[model samples]
Target: MKDLACQQFQDTVAEFLIRHQSILDIISKSQESNARVNRAVVKAVTHCGCVKVRAEKSAIPPEATLADLKQLLDSHLDGELCPNCREIIESEMGKSIFYLTALCHSLGLSLADVLQREHEKVSTLRVFNFT
Candidate 1:
């Protein structure tokens, strides 16, 4: 079911991406869309004041293990996205995904397959994946 949705999205992107047919265009647009996503999140925190970031260095004890790091670390986010901010962020994220799918289509890659492989890798590796 999830794979179907991903394939559908990829197909839709390939169909609609008439203007940005060039690989350069797809890559640049993908970057722009990603920047928009980051901008939307910043707006939610700064302009909307719906959320606040209280980020600081993690104080990991010398004896802490990899599993314990999960409990020790913090996202540092306070509150939540307001409805308006949430909508904007979702829209921006959709654009990001569209461009990402378009990039995959241009490269003759399957987004669903890529996602599945990554999922399997992360699932198998668990916390050690990052390290």
Candidate 2:
């Protein structure tokens, strides 16, 4: 019903990105610190119902195994990999932005347009804003 303003839209998207970046920073730090990596991965798998009630379940695929993923993260950290964890973090964060951008593009909506609409919606809400 209303045309989205560019400044408001960009600010809203920037805020969203900043919040996601903060969460990612915590995860990345945990990975680098080697704290709870195995436990977190295991918990995620179990929560997804991937594990069996019996003693053993199906083996994790080589590529998808937590071990492999951690190795990848570690290699990325060591500078042996072209992009350190920082690059990986950026790429992962970029993914959501890229996906939203693609969807907007396909729907004939500019990011500036949708973002401004979302901003207005957030601002209009009295109790809470970030969403």
Candidate 3:
């Protein structure tokens, strides 16, 4: 619940910027076209500061945990992104969702349970606030 609480805070700021006329128009067009443009923009270019893979053969390293991600990123960044910065994005994207599952091992809640609880909070807040 605490982790979910913080993610909501980060999402609020992102939603605010994306609510602009030009931003919303771009999002709407991508949705209408059923294009990967929206996802590429949001996931990589917007937040992660990378682009979607342009070639098929080059592989991103397998990221199953924060440590795994750190290794993969370290190999690329060479200390460019500080540890704190890396943690923030990974937590936001829940990029290593598999890591979340591992972290939740033996816990009763499923991913669906976690998502529903988090979504419920967002749904209740029509206007985003960092409460």
User: For model 3, how does the per-residue alpha-carbon lDDT over 14-110 read when each residue is reduced to its tens digit?
Assistant: 3543332254453453344333433433445346654333333434566454445444432232224345445555554443343344323324345
Name the Cα RMSD for model 1.
0.8
All models: lDDT?
0.94, 0.46, 0.45
TM-score for each predicted model, relative to the true structure: 0.97, 0.33, 0.28
Candidate 1, residue 24: Cα displacement in angstroms equals 0.4
How much does each candidate deviate from the true structure in C-alpha RMSD? Answer: 0.8, 17.7, 15.0
| Candidate 1 off by > 4 Å | none
- Please list all clashing residue pairs in model 2, or write none if there are none: none
Best by lDDT: 1
Mind giving the per-residue lDDT tens digits that candidate 2 earns over 1-131?
33445444434554555433454453454344343444433443454333323343444566674435443432111112223433544555455454454445434567876777877787797335522
Candidate 1 per-residue lDDT, tens place, 28-77, comes to 99899999999999999989999999999989999999999899998899
The clash tally of candidate 2 reads: 0
TM-score of decoy 2: 0.33
**Between candidates 1 and 3, the lDDT winner:** 1
Q: Compare candidates 1 and 2 on lDDT and give the better one.
A: 1
